[model samples]
Target: MVTALRGVSERAEAWLDVERERIGLWLPVALGAGIAAWFALPAMIQWIGLLFLLAAGALVGVLAGWQRRLGRIAAVGSAVMAAGLLLIWARASWVAAPVLAQPAVTAFSAEVEAVEPQPAREQVRLIVRPLRRPDLPPRVRLTLRGDGDGIAPGAFVGLRARLMPPPTASLPGGYDFAQRAWFDRIGAVGTVLGDVVRSPGARRGSQPLRARLSAHIHAQVAGSPGGIAAALVTGDRGAISPEDDEAMRRAGLAHLLSISGLHVTAVIGFAMLVAMRLFALSRRLALAGYVLPIAAAAGALAGAGYTWLAGAEVPTLRSLIAALLVLVAFLMGREALTLRLVAAGALIVLLWRPESLAGPSFQLSFAAVTAIVALHESPMMRRFLARRDEALPLRWGRALAGLLITGLVVELALAPIALFHFHKAGLYGALANVVAIPLTTFVIMPMEAAGLLFDSVGLGTPFWWVADHALRLLIALAHAVADTPGAVATMPSFPRWGFALTVGGGLWILIWRTRWRWAGAVPLAIGIAALLAQPRPDLLITGDGRNIAAAVPGGGYALLRNRAGDFVRDTMSEAAGIDAPLGALADLDHVECNADFCRWRQGAEEGVTRAGQGIARGEQDAAARVILASRGRDRIEGAEMAAACAAADVVISDRWLPRECAGRWLTIDRDSLAQSGGLAIYFGERPRVVAALRAGDEHPWRQPDQLSGNDEAVPTDALAP
Candidate 1:
């Protein structure tokens, strides 16, 4: 026992030494822990704990920075964790402050904080802060219904508008729009009641510099190729068409629209190289001081300027920070692309917005960089690089092989995350990237950058035209790739625990500098197994309880209504990993649909139903296993329909069921749907039901009662009374 204890102690000491040597890794780990802690907290108590953590973190930071070797690891880790907790909590609390009985419709004088024009919708997104209400959320996003041409960023305007808080997730295991809105400081969404006439009382706020820059670029290239040019240069995607965006996403080229590591690196690298060369040409200044410092400074400034011009969104900001870290490392005469530099950039981002840790943007960005660093340091890559000075043919072969390997590694690193979040992987992403990346990097981005700079002086037309043509080719390539057979492979949604395990395993594999890192494969494999075993919900109902889709036994969705809305159909298809066409009902084995009802059955099962003409008062309807209510037909006034629903095992309706009919059957109605957001029902002897917005969502952000003011109650599908 003594020998074993000594051995364990020695191993632990050695591990601790390794960690100390790689001290920077602790920051990212702590940041992750802080985010985890924040999410683990109950909604009600989250803010309170965050406040306490803030004060504690500040104290720890002060103490830690005071001495170099006074329990340095423990102090640094504690400080980082505290700082992470504080940042997220403070931001959340400030953005999501409680407001009771905010008017849904009101006339208020407002200053347009920012204007994001959507050419596709012939509308404009106005970020407005109310002039009068101190109690209102700090900002509201208002979509002006029509062409509000004269309106620009910083223009104050007054108009009557309907405002409501951002919506919660429409379904269980769906994106949390409310959480996203909270971080964006968007208290509510509104629509203009009428024309957005500029109010004389409107005061100009700080101008949206990025929006102005993008608008200027768009004006120069207004008709033909301005959208992609503006997007590439200014990170403004407002002009890109929905079709193009979808094509890019499906082809795994959507990252081109966003300002990311590639863009930042290119912009800063070009600036640095130019600045260094210019400085070197002047021998006096070059000899006076280190050219590296001057060049690095120039690059950092360029990155910062570009980030500011790109709205400094999370992804852009992350890219800028990463660029700065690499530049600063170069200035310090250290290798720029080290793990320490990666950790520093990640730590800065987490400190700024710890919530980013959960977002796909952060995960993919950091994972790709980390994987690249690991690959660079791997024995295989080192061996290849050792022969870089060989013959020209061999060198070219090495370059091609390196590119292929890098692309593969990045795809592999991001695949699990993409699958978990989107439930679809781009089957031809690497091929698409290989074809598109060079054109984007070498041709399109450079021209766009030149266009943006020259457009102000009327010299950018040729550059803009060149960029546009390149973009056209890129788009054509993307569409071609996306349309290829098996271009995207949809998979079932992975469970949260499984995703968490995958993340943990991946981090272990990347961060642990030991042979034991292979142990991460064990958990990774388990996570994959867990995902495979997870089952899709049998039936899903929309938030308004107006639409539903039931899963077929073999794995596909059948519309409960023949003409399901886009939201219902898309959500169901995505959840079930079935890329069915819109309003597709053919997937079900034995399906029948009419204006009155839609029904389907599989083998021995008593299948699902909708309250329709063919379904009403039928003997099959009366004994139906599950009955879905008709859309826009909430009132069940007739005795026959009520009687049939009452006899059914589960009744889902959008309208009000007769009072007498409600007691016998399990009914999900308008009131419940309104409160819960959406419903998921599983079919079996004992059906399981889940609500999108549960009792816990009674928190300030999800006041269900407040959300549905004066809305009429209707019935929805219910498994139990």
Candidate 2:
């Protein structure tokens, strides 16, 4: 043990010496670690308090370094880590908007701040300042029942709403809507009770520029193609139908729809080329000064403008930073793409919004770019590119080869991240990118930009018509690819620790400059093995406890719900790596579900027998394993309730808890669901409870005080005294 410790200490010392000249390379990584620490922490820290702690830590670190003769770089690294902590804490505190304190609100008046397009209806963002109760959250996101035609941004409108707090994850390890809502500063979400009445003084201007552009696009053209155009132009995907969106995602063409690195680079490149040519044509400019700077400036403006038009989302923002760095390189007469610039951009972005570190967009985008740049800088790639003296056709062939290589590298780099977050990857992503990328960069984007310009002069229809045609072709290709056999592959939920391991390995590979970097593959392989070994949950219960899904024998899940439960069933199926639809899986041969109950017959299926019988509902003692009840409670009398309780080993309520279930056997009700977020039951020798929301999840966003207690008994008649 002592020998090992000494060896580790020596290695660490050598590593520090090596990193001294490249300490800046580790800043973004340290910042990312700090952001991760914030997420793992049990409590949220105030910005002021975090700043004080940071100051104290910096002072201590510096004093210790001076007293102990520690290297200045090492000491500064400690201070930088402290700074990172302060950045994330400050950003979180700054964005911690008020949340509604009420458990349920039947009615409230709000001033409509913005109107957004949705596939089903018009979603409205309202600023609600209650005259009687000023303590409640001021901003709320309300989804109306229909298309609010007259409603626009900045419209002061009054509407009755039935509001509830933003929902948490519906099932264990599922989507965390509450976390997203917290960052978005949306306190409550609900539907309008009726038509929104706009005040006579209703106006506009508070709406985001991107939202307004999206509205205009929809007004100009209506349909899926128009939705595609709007999404490509303004990053507003609200109008796209679920079918189209899913098809695009499965085909791996979804990135083209969003303004990303490809779009920004292509647009800037085209603009610079145009500016250069125009300047070259002018004799006065040719005689005056260097035209490269002027053309590069124009390209920068174009990139920034596109970023604003696309709402400056994470991907677009990262690409814009890259474009600016390229311009800076041009001005300095140096190569544009470099590792140092990538690090600088990453540091700037992390400092700007530390919360972005947790998002898939940021992770996947940065990973792909970093890998692509590293590949371009490799010795072998440089040797390959040196063959520019070859024939024109050979050079063209090389370019095509490079494009294919680029696609493969990016897809490979993003594979683990996609699996960790989405659990699905497109098998034909590289081929799809080869065809789709050039089409988007050269044709679709330019056409749309031209259309936007021409529309201002009343000559936009032709350009838009051409753009729509291209979109149709792209959609067709996506549908074709997505429909292909095994076009997309799904995997079981990858463990978070495995993801962490993979990320660490990737960073080591990218950040190191030594042959020892190959050692990263060790952790990468181990992480994949761990991910493959992770077990899928046997059963999932929705947060309301109204819907339940049990894994089927081969794959997929059989759901038992009073209503359609599409979201829960599909989510569970995906996590289980089930490729089929929920409805198709609902009628698995071994499963029998009726209006009152669902039962898995023993010995009817191979895997189900070992997995245990999943029983839900029915009055007889035959369904003793599990009983789920939601409806007919208003119909059941006192005696019926007692009999129902006596018949089952466990009883679950979708709406409210019954007093009879307080300590008898085990019960999951709305109260427990609210407190726990969601439930995953693993039927090993005996059933075990696995909560979605851990003890550490009780942050300000959750507003734990508003959630019901786990052991609390709720009366069947909630309004009863």
TM-score of 1: 0.85
lDDT agreement with native, every candidate: 0.70, 0.70
Per-residue C-alpha lDDT of model 1 across residues 529-561, encoded as one tens digit per residue: 887776667777777676777665456566666
Per-candidate TM-scores read: 0.85, 0.85
The positional error of residue 486 in candidate 1, measured at the CA in angstroms, is: 1.9
User: Where does candidate 2 stray beyond 4 Å?
Assistant: 1-22, 43-74, 102-105, 119-135, 201-212, 215-222, 583-604, 607-651, 655-666, 685-688, 704-721
